[model samples]
Target chain A: EPEVTQTPSHQVTQMGQEVILRCVPISNHLYFYWYRQILGQKVEFLVSFYNNEISEKSEIFDDQFSVERPDGSNFTLKIRSTKLEDSAMYFCASSEEGLGNQPQHFGDGTRLSIL
Target chain B: AQTVTQSQPEMSVQEAETVTLSCTYDTSESDYYLFWYKQPPSRQMILVIRQEAYKQQNATENRFSVNFQKAAKSFSLKISDSQLGDAAMYFCAYSPNSGNTPLVFGKGTRLSVIA
Candidate 1:
């Protein structure tokens, strides 16, 4: 079965540095999302993207975060400045359509470690 | 706002035994979707099963099944003939049936299958 794929399974960056996490959603998927989980915490929604624009974002998704669908297949999340609290597992998910009734498929998360 | 709650933080089951994980949610929306996702040690989030709020029939996938109580806003996952591979972190998530809604996830229950 086709699945969402994320690059740089583990990323280590210095505090205050910029980091970009990349994802390649299923070819036919129309909606994409980014979520994060602090160690021992619940997974929290970050942002949702559709039609090359952000559809919705959470309070956690502040000024530092931005998402882009730079190409037909690649969706990326960039953090302008990494903080120590930013250390967590970042996950990418996608669904065939934007309607919430459809199941979203998640990728193996990228573990972001800020030093 | 929708909130998913997983009462049990951890659970253990003997191999081949049946185990149930409890999940409850508070949502104002009449139509939505509930999902159970499994994350193994690798931390790959895998969709185990999903239930549509409008459907009265329970959703089942092979050995995995759900008891969905729409009126009570309760959804529980039942794993039958549990195996060693079933040891993982299980998350209960909810999403409204709206355009591009992000999934809201519970804190998750850690399930351990003992041999």
Candidate 2:
């Protein structure tokens, strides 16, 4: 019953500052993803990574956002410039294989608040 | 682009009762996966159930089951003999291409189980 784990369950950052959200995906997973849910809004896709590179990303994942598997187990999302609209609960997920039947398991989200 | 919609913003059911949360999606791709994720007060996204578009039979897992209508582009979750723990925000999601792609989620429905 391994699970994805995220660091700093709550993060408060000043506007225009850089913030990194870290996550340790399940050990054997091959695909990783980042999603965020703004209060009262739907969960939005940010980015997906595999083979040590970004496989796909949403429009929300613009130039300001970047993801890296800096190490074997850690996947990090970095926001170069934070804004009030960037505040949300960020979730990390991983899947053994990115197949239609293989579902992704998510970590307890990191609540990010940009001032 | 694919979009998942959860029409009901909130639903309530008495303990030991049954409740069904509706979900519909708009996708042109013939092969895709549908999922239901439950988020409790802790804000952890937990996978509840899943369905493959190619499967003609509906998918069921313990007390959780899905009524999937591929033609109608509908995937609904039914919680039988609901318990208090079933109270959470339910999000219906869609994943296309069966590759390292991101999940598209619905706005989510808040389920409240009364004791």
Candidate 3:
């Protein structure tokens, strides 16, 4: 089965620096999403994109966070200024459709660490 | 707002036995979806099973099954004939029927399968 793929499985960035996490969602999937899981914590939703625009976002998704589908399969999450609290495993997901019954497939996740 | 809760922080089961992970959620929406995701040590989020609120029958995938009680707002995952690979962080997630809404996840239950 096709799976969502993320690059730079581990990322270490200095606080206040910009970092971009890249993901290549399954080829035929349309809906895209970003989520984060701090160590030993629940996974938290960040943002969802469809039709080339953000459909919904969580409060955790602040102004410093932005997502873009630069091309057909490349969906990127960019953090303008990283903070220590931003250190977590970031996961990207995609689904063939946004229907409730359709499952969202997730990537292996990118582990981001801020100094 | 929707919130999912996994009361059991951790659980253990012997290989070839069965184990159940508990999950509950608070949701006002009548139409929604529930999911169980397994995150192994590699931190890859793998979809285990899914249930639709409208469906009365529980969903089953191989050794994985769900006991969904809509009235009680409970969705639990049961892994029968457990293997070492079943050891992972199990997350319960919820989402409204709307396509724009993102998934709300619980704190997750860490399952350890002993050989």
Candidate 4:
């Protein structure tokens, strides 16, 4: 089965530095998403992307966060200024369609660690 | 707003035995989707099963089955003939029927299968 792929399984960055997490969703998928999980906490939605635009975002997705589909296959999430609280497991997911019933395929996740 | 709750923080079961992970949600929307995702030590989020709110029959996949009580707003996952590989953190998630809505996940339940 095809799977979503994320790069830099673990990322360590300075508190004030910028960080970009990359994901390659399934080739045929049309919708993409970003979610985060704090250690021992529930997974939180960050943003959803479709047609190169953000479809929805949570309050947790503030000014510091932005998502871009720079190319056909790569979707990226950039944090303008990282903070200690931003350290978490960032996951990428995709679905064949934007329909609610479609199952989202997930990647292993990128563990972001802010120093 | 939608919220998912996994009351059991951790559970244990003997290999070849059966176990159930409980989940409840608060959602005003009549049509929605429920999912159970498993995350092993590797932190890869894997889709275990899914249930549609409008369906009266429970969703089952092989040894994985769900007990979905729409009236009670409960969706539970049952693992039959558990194996050591089943030891993982399981998350219950909910999403509105709208394609634009993102998923809301519970804190998760950690299952430990003993040999």
Compare the candidates by TM-score and give the number of the best one: 4
lDDT of 4 by residue, A1-114 (tens): 899999999999999999999999999999999999999899999999999999989999999999999979999999999999999999999998877788888999999999
lDDT of 2 by residue, A51-80 (tens): 999998988999999999987989999999
Model 4, runs deviating above 4 Å: none
TM-score of 3: 0.97
Question: Model 4 over residues B1-115: C-alpha lDDT tens digits?
Answer: 7889999999999999999999999989999999999999988899999999999999999999999999999999999999999999999999889866678899999999999
- lDDT, residue B106, candidate 1: 99
Q: After superposition, how far is residue B114 of candidate 3 from its true place, in Å?
A: 0.8
Docking quality tier of model 4: high
- Residue A42 lDDT in model 3? 87
lDDT of 1 by residue, B44-115 (tens): 899899999999999999999999999899999999999999999999999999888999999999999999
lDDT of 1 by residue, A1-80 (tens): 99899999999999999999999999999999999999989999999998999999999999999999997999999999
How many clashing pairs per prediction, in order? Answer: 0, 0, 0, 0
* Residues B1-115, model 3: lDDT tens digits: 7899999999999999999999999989999999999989887899899999999999999999999999999999999999999999999999899866778999999999999
- Between the candidate structures 3 and 4, which one is better when assessed by DockQ? 4
Instruction: Report the number of the highest-lDDT candidate.
Output: 1
Candidate 2, superposed: residue stretches over 4 Å from native: none
Clash pairs, model 1 backbone: none
TM-score of 4: 0.98
Q: Give the distance in Å from residue A1's predicted Cα in candidate 4 to where it truly belongs.
A: 1.2
Alpha-carbon TM-score of each model against the true structure? 0.98, 0.97, 0.97, 0.98
